[model samples]
Target: MTHKILIADDEPNIVISLEYLLQREGYAVLVARDGQEALDTIAREQPALVLLDVMMPHKTGFEVCQAVRADEAL
Candidate 1:
């Protein structure tokens, strides 16, 4: 099965590059422009992995990580 990967970053270049690279390797990629969106996407998509930015709009990467860990369902 194709594993889903989430790229959570506000940088367009990084997101585009990573998406292209991961897609080329046949992995399904999802994107979030900000930390809040990242959290929402994470909950909805349940991606196998997430590439998050340390600093983002709405919330930080560390905050997102903490939320994920704190949530038992996630």
Candidate 2:
């Protein structure tokens, strides 16, 4: 089974690099530029794993993780 992954990072380079790497490894990859976007993507897509950066605009990775942890859909 292919496991989907959500990537939340502020840097475009990091996002692209990881996107390429994960995709090449046969996993479905999703990218988010910030924490809020990450949270939104997670809510909409419900990926199996999330790679979140600690520092991001609007909300931090900690906040996103908390939200995901609290979300009943997860």
**Candidate 2, 1-74: lDDT as tens digits:** 89999999999999999999999999999989998899889988889999999999999999998998897886
Clashes within 3 Å, all models in order: 0, 0
List model 1 lDDT by residue over 1-74, tens digit each: 99999999999999999999999999999999999999999999999999999999999999999999999887
**For each candidate, what is the lDDT?**
0.98, 0.93
The lDDT, on a scale of 0 to 1, for candidate 2 is 0.93
Badly placed stretches (over 4 Å) of model 1 are none
| True lDDT of residue 72, candidate 1 | 89
Q: Residue 6 error for model 2, in Å?
A: 0.6
TM-score of each: 0.98, 0.92
Among these predictions, the greatest lDDT belongs to 1
